[model samples]
Target: MTRREEIVDVAERLLERGGPEAVTMRRLADELGIQAPSLYKHVAGKPEIEAALQQRALQRLAAALEAAPDLPSLAAAYRRWALRHPRLYEIATRLPLARERLAPGVEAAAAAPLLRVTGGDLTAARALWGLAHGLVDLELAGRFPPGADLDAVWTHAMAARVAAGPGPGVTG
Candidate 1:
């Protein structure tokens, strides 16, 4: 691979091992066998590197999300990705910047996978995003408590959402 591509791979390892804080320009330089100044030729700074890394993570996650056939399968796949690639998944979702800060093509590339599944309407799409994203985020955070049957709970929740429907106020 080329030098810039090599740098991205090294940065990915650094992110996978240490999360955001572990990836410094100097540390990346050290890992890359190049001086810190030379490193700037590939990535502008730590901020840019972090953004690129997050973009990479998002693209990976989007690909995984796309491979699943449906929502339950998608959730299972998401859990698997989170469990297997916790640091990268975390970096993908937890970058400490606004959506605007993300690279121009990165979010679009990453979201293409999801947007394909969530077409037609905005409200339904928003709810689906909220449900899936929230569930995965909570699962990663261990919010379900120990020894609990998350599969059953998740099924019930999904059922309720399906039955209740995202509509006008139904409360009595």
Candidate 2:
């Protein structure tokens, strides 16, 4: 791996182990067997490294979405990806990249799951994306009853909406 890739790999591992707060430049340099200064040759610093991770997480998410066998199966994949990379997941969901910093088309790709369904223009597209994301977050946070799996609940909800049918589609 390139030095940049190596740095990001280490940061992601730290995130997996202890969440965002645990990922530090010193710890990353230690894990890499290189001094902290060496990281600057590759990444700007802790903040930039975290931003790199955010983009990488979105790329990983895009791959996960593409690899799913079908749309309905994606809920489980989504949860698995989130739990597997909790800090990265949190960063990916919460971090707001500076307008100039986002990799072109990455945000669009990250929101592809909802976009594929509604094919809505940007405004409606954002609304559907919010619905999908809000449902996932709320469910994961245990906002519902005990013994509940919000992922499954979300899938059922999506299925019910589709089965409910569309306007002017005719036939029951």
Candidate 3:
């Protein structure tokens, strides 16, 4: 891997282990067995490191969403991705990326599959996204009471959404 990719990989590891605060330049350098200045050669600073991580996380989410065979599958895929990468999920969803700061089409490309599944209904797409995110966030927080079957919960939630038939003003 390139130096930049290596740096981001270590940063992602740090993020997974201890959230964003753990990914300081010095810490990354130390982890990579290099001086802080070497990191600067590839990344401008912490913000750039964060942006790179965010971009990578978003790309993964988008890929997961795109690979779903159907709407309910999309929900399943979303949940799986978040559960597999809770820290990255938090980074991608909880931390909003200023549109102007992101590469053109990055956000749109990620949302495209969901939008298509919702039949161009942005509201429905958003609602689906919200449902998946809420469930995963709560799951990650261990908010579910003892013996609560998460798979059953997710299946029930997706079934309910599918049965709801679509939101008001959404024809499909």
Candidate with maximal TM-score: 3
* Candidate-wise lDDT, in order: 0.71, 0.70, 0.84
Per-residue lDDT over 91-116 for candidate 1, one digit per residue giving the tens place of the 0 to 100 score: 77777744666667766665554444
The TM-score values for the models, in the order shown, are 0.77, 0.77, 0.85
Model 3 Cα shift for residue 22 (angstroms):
3.4
- The residue-by-residue lDDT of candidate 3 on 14-95, one tens digit each, is 9999977888899999999999988888887887777878888888899988977788788888888888998898788777
Worst 10 residues of 2 by lDDT: 163-172
Regions more than 4 Å wrong, model 2: 67-71, 74-76, 120-124, 139-145, 149-152, 163-172
lDDT of 2: 0.70
Models sorted by lDDT, best on top: 3, 1, 2
Task: State, as a TM-score between 0 and 1, how close model 2 is to the true structure.
Answer: 0.77
**How close to the true structure is residue 5 of candidate 1, measured as C-alpha lDDT?**
72
Best by the lDDT measure: 3
